[model samples]
Target: MTSQRAPLEPLVPHPRAPVVPQASIIPPPPLPPPAPASGPAPPHVFGLEKSHLLKEALEKAGPVPSGREDVKRLLKLHKDRFRNDLQWILFCAELPSLIQEGPQCGLVALWMASTLLVPPDGVPLDRLLQVALERGYTAQGEMFSVADMGKLAQEVLGCHTELLCGGLGGPNRDYILQHIIAGHPLLVPYDEDFNHEPCQRRGHKAHWAVSAGVLLGVVAVPSLGYAEDPELAGLFHPVPSTPYQPPPLPEEGFSGAIYLLSKQGKSWHYQLWEYGQVQESNLQLTDFAPSRAMDGRAYVVPAGGVRSGLCGQALLLRQHDTSH
Candidate 1:
């Protein structure tokens, strides 16, 4: 008995894909449009105009007064207030600073903004959460939509809101300086670098804060406490309460200087921090660039060592219009 076998057939290319001589020459399939990201929609999605311009102004650097005395002096910041600066208190419209338990920075920021109204509001955190609920801002009652948070400020606090974002954690310095100096309290949506402070040393979280005003060249932050929150019970950074030394007299000698080394092309430009202000310096340490400058003679802070959650994204909370 004998069996018949089938004949071989020629290969053909699919009509959609043309044959290429080599697999390497063939193009890969187009990637699916990135799935709508899990977080809040951008400001443009909520109908805000956009523009392009220069925003490079930075704070005038100054010696933050070297001492183991205060926590503000530790962060390479020329000046900042931890909890109870009179200026920050006034800037917060006489409202108390807020602290979040767990992850409620956004709600705390909104509550602070509410105080700008006449008779001084006391918008409860629960109300803000309710707003978040109605706006679909939160998923599972924790994470929130930054866009909706902006809307929450406007809707709940009754203020005109203008949103801005830097994408990268660092914002346009001018935007921070301009809005803060102009007395517009900004509700900034940011990521808390847990490692920015000593105790929490690890990850980052999507958070928010109130930039109450500018305190001594640095942006004054009044709300959303980290180091100062007692409720956390040492789970977070503790408030620095050691005695800080007062400024030295002329005979006591100059304390030292703060230098801001900004990267320019392949080299770094040195900006001198003088008398509590940043001044442009033509300082040419040809042999000692910032990359090689850190040797403990001066307290050295690298570019990566500094970050600000507030400046990255802002929702400016303009004072409520009394005329209307």
Candidate 2:
């Protein structure tokens, strides 16, 4: 009986629940936009005024002091004379196109006059005049008659004899002649102008080489002896007609040179170089606009002297080390 009762109690039914689908509940948190990248702003492009300010700061900061007072004095004097002479040249260069001829001739004359007044250590005014006359006469196919050229020399010499007497004498004449020969034949005698035709027509190597040398002289003169291991004198020495070539560009170590050209209806523009490589800069004719071209307006970097950028509307020379 007990077994029967237990079986009846087991018959009770079990409760069941309905199934519900949950929605794809939460969407991914919206991805935050990628953070913007950040860096330092570009450096301010250098300008003339900025360059000047920087130069002044560097100068004020001081450099390795040159030891000799006399050397400093000589350099100062040389710089002053160079500035003055270059100014005179640039001033003469500004006349009407018709008188453009005057400046080059004027430079030649001035060089002669300066030589007469302050002949360098070994050169004499008379001898320099003689050499120039000989070259001029030779170009004309006429025998050099010192009398003719001497007249001009005499006038200059007479006017500046005291100055010319300074170093005018022996080996300096030959030395200067060597340099003149090395220089470009920018001024050819009217008769020898035809000789240059070959160069103009065929692109003569001699012509370009000489031109380069002359340009070197022009650019290097102001900076000579201002730096260590000066090569201005060597640069001015005429290249031999043989196979000898100048030292490799890098080896030559040309610090750099500045060239200024004034365009018609435009401002002055400059070209810069270092070890024969041109440097790119934003400065151009528009940068120096409206000012007429002047001779002494150039800023030269001395052979090994340290300086960055040039200043002055006309001509000014200030010594500052740029080797930093």
- Using TM-score, give the best candidate's number: 1
Best by lDDT: 1
What RMSD, rounded to one decimal, does every model reach?
Answer: 24.4, 39.1
Off by over 4 Å in 2: 1-146, 159-174, 177-324
As for candidate 1, its clashing pairs are: 60-278, 61-277, 61-278
**Residue lDDT tens for model 2, 67-128:** 12222333354443222222110100110110111112222322322321333311332343
- Candidate 1, residue 69: CA error in Å? 14
Candidate 2, TM-score vs. the true structure? 0.18
TM-score of each: 0.40, 0.18
Global lDDT for candidate 2?
0.21
The Cα local distance difference test for each model comes to 0.34, 0.21
